[model samples]
Target chain A: MTLAQWSFDLLLAGGLLWLGWQALFEKRRFSAVVHFMAFNLLMALVWVRLSAPDIALAEAAIGAGVTGALLLTALGRLPSGTSSGAHPHRWHPHWRYLAVISACISTAWLIAVVPQLPSPGLAGEIEAVMPATGVDHAVTAVLLNIRALDTLLEVAVMLAAVVLVWSLGPTLRPLPPATILPGLPALSRLLHPLFLLVPTYLLWRGTHAPGGAFPAGAVLGAGGVLMLLADEVGWMQRQHWQRLLRLLLVSGLALFVLVGLGGLLMTGTFLSIPLGVARLLIMAVEIAMALSIALMLMALYLYGEPGQ
Target chain B: MSDYYATVAALLCGMAVIGLFRAHDLLHRILALNVLASAVFLLLVTLARTESGTDPVPHVMVLTGIVVAVSTTAAALALTIRAYERRRQREDER
Candidate 1:
């Protein structure tokens, strides 16, 4: 909290608010998407300000990068007229705007009053229990150990969502052919190995640094998306990988659940694997999750079959 | 003051909601929703940084939120793509 940092944060928050308002009130869908992207980037900066570098990276990669790509892909699939046309009706309805304003103000007021609220007295309780669980990170302890069941369920939900999407038929559009990037083939050839290096580095760095599964997964996903976008792989070729991709998608959840259950056999508790084993198991689960997430995201972006 | 950053974050959140409400196209709405999610993440992180040292709770919360966000986004995109295909099919028939 230097004055400078404080002011910077204020500027970002104000910018976010302004962008959000503009995006909502704006009539044009294309403009709204641009504004939304801007808003996401600013939000990532806000995460950085909050001392959560891990989240900041995720926001930047997944929230801003991958999400934006998905939106743009969807936009491409839609009929141009539907998005480009003006609304048939005038933008009146002042009452609705008023309502939104009132709701937002009330919510802000409530948040402002949170400081005055009494402490829950759970912080100490949780801290006391942390060592007993053999986990150092309080949040990790809560998410993976104490509330391991919840985490497992959450992973299941993610898996179910992917399955649900798969049940829906042919959503992928034929991507346009890639043109040679001027003098870039040589560069790409040189950089291909570098790209491989980056994701592995990110994964290894996650052990101690702010990077983690989510961000690393996103980066890997982006690489895949880029390859497709560049038409490096033919649609028919990509189709051949579908079965393998499906396995990768579920591998993370499978690893997590199996290891967690193994703990039950030994320790007589779900997700309560021994300390040294737990770290190794969690890391394994994370790697799997990262791969699963990346594939799932890429598939979602690509929609159904690539050729169709 | 820190309030300024909070205000900016709050404002972005508002804009995101506005984008969602105003968007006529499904893709636009999805983008707006992502914006809103980002703003919320920012708000949480900011609030969590009040003390001298960083709070692990918010970091973990944000991490989990990111995974959840991406998962939901994937599902939503899949649904949207399906809807688009069906619409196109109906159009061709007509």
Candidate 2:
């Protein structure tokens, strides 16, 4: 390994640790949010360094961008006393001491054991079966084809989360009503085109490269969030769009299940697309997943009960 | 090598766990959980690397993990925010 590469790696690792500590220990809520966002950005870079560009793109969009927005919104909405600062509690000292000790032991155990574990070399297996999946990108192939049940369940999880948040419902009042911040309208208008274009490009490139439904969905979700914050999402609550929103919310999982059922009826196995139509099926599923994931993420962000 | 990342991941895991124990605030606890999730992903990706290249399976897993983490975080923060508001209202009545 080159000296420069080693130095870069060390620097990145050190920065991540410092940022994480600051995010955790900062007394002020705003500073902690800043630190956490920085930590997320650095984490994305680390993924890229680790040679997982697909994961890197998803991390940057969903992990850093959408999650940061959610945290900041929660910070704004939370009652005053319960800000980010650690509150005093009985038995705090004992618990903290125990925590530190456990942390040390676990760290030691992982360090000692991780290197000794064998690599299952799943990459080669993925490569060998790549031709059958019809997607050129291995990550997409695995996500949409080989181990697709996980992805289907993942979509279900997102929908379930939105349901959970909605079931919690609005508090005594509906979150102080959404207010438009200064300059947000102009900003949303300016970036609106990019949101549509980027997600489309991402979905197209996903069949061949390091982009896919998740990142594309995240980008679109961000756009939805921007619209929400700008108070431009009133149309979403209209009677006509309500059903559309509901349908979009469940489309990914529904399409996924239907395709799996189709495979079962045609072939003996479930979710096994025939070789001739693999590419089309995968693309159809990816597009549906992207749309459904985007709507689900945006709904999760709004934190409003759907039927209200 | 990937081992260096593994060590970093371990340290991060430790920090996050400690943070969770000490964080009394709900937001702090959620943030700690996020850090811990990041550590797990780092470990997975580091382990996925082979002599030829990185494994797509773990990469896909981490991608799924990121989405799941966000969904859970959103739900958790929503609950926390509602609880805090309810507590404030009760104090007001008192």
Candidate 3:
């Protein structure tokens, strides 16, 4: 690598470490959150430096963007007047010092001793079968085709999460949204079409490039969060609308299973697409999953039923 | 250069563990947990770097992990909010 490249990586590494520390050790929870979001966004750049474009996109949308919004919402809901960020320790928590010291020692030792893992693992194998998986992108093929069982389980996990959170009972939504900036509603309205179009474009482009369901769904979910933050989702309070949202949340997992079953019947093995219709089947599952992921993430941001 | 990342990852893991251990607040703990997760993601991706190119398999694993991490974080946040609200409500009644 060039000297310039070396320095760039050094700066990125320093920034990540500093941000990670700030995200936790900072006195204010709010600042910690902001640091955490910055850390994730920087991590996306790290992924790009490592030549992992797919993960870079996913990290940017889901990690840096949606997670920041979720943290902000949770912060608002936390009961106030508590002595936040004030620990009653007489001295620094000694156990923490011990832990960090031991962890660093062990981690350094392990890296020095452990042999490097042979690279090109599974990339060669996955790439060879990419054409059969119906996607030109290796990551998508690995995610949705060759080892689709993992993806299936992941969608199910998303469903389970929504169900668990929903059972936590309704909390109050911030009415009149005292927290949002005055101009955000107008901005959210302006960008609303891009929110819809961008995800669609990503989903369509996923077959050939770095775009795919996870990032697209995350972008859509972030849009939902934007609408919620701007207090423009008044219609979500309707009793019947809750049922529709619930169905949408459940549809991703259900459709994945149904598609898996269909694949089983068509081919002898389950979850394996026939070579002839690989593209069609993968795209179908991807669309259903993207929609479901979008709703599930949005519902998660709601934290509970939308308060009237 | 990737070794530099490995060292960073190691340091992150250590720091995040300390943060997770020392944090008294639920939100602080969650943030530390996330930092820890990012450390693991970084280590794996760095390892996936080969003389030829970056590997796709570990990339897939880390991507799925990112989605999973967000879901769990949301669930944890929801639980935290519920418990805090209930405690406040109980105090009000008392």
User: Against the true structure, whose TM-score is highest?
Assistant: 2
Q: In model 2, which runs have C-alpha deviations exceeding 4 angstroms?
A: A82-89, A92-95, A170-180
The residue ranges of model 1 lying beyond 4 angstroms of the native Cα positions read: A82-98, A104-151, A176-191, A233-240, A305-308, B1-4, B50-53
Alpha-carbon error at A210 in model 1, in Å? Answer: 1.8
Per-residue lDDT value at A159 in model 2: 89
What lDDT score is found at residue B65 in candidate 3?
Answer: 95
Q: Mind giving the per-residue lDDT tens digits that candidate 3 earns over A7-106?
A: 9998999999999999989868788999999999999999999888888888988899889988987887775543333355644657756766787788
lDDT of 2 by residue, A23-73 (tens): 988867778888999999999999989888888888888888889988988
TM-score of 1: 0.82
Q: Write the per-residue lDDT of candidate 1 for residues B1-94, one digit (tens) a residue.
A: 3454555556666556655666676666666776667666656655654434444565566677776776777678677667766777887999
> DockQ for the candidate 2 complex?
0.71
lDDT of 2 by residue, B39-63 (tens): 9999989999989777888888899
Q: What TM-score, computed on C-alpha atoms, does each candidate reach? A: 0.82, 0.94, 0.93
Ranking by TM-score: 2, 3, 1
i-RMS, every candidate?
4.0, 1.9, 2.6
Reference contacts preserved by each model: 0.46, 0.79, 0.70
lDDT, model 1, position A22: 60
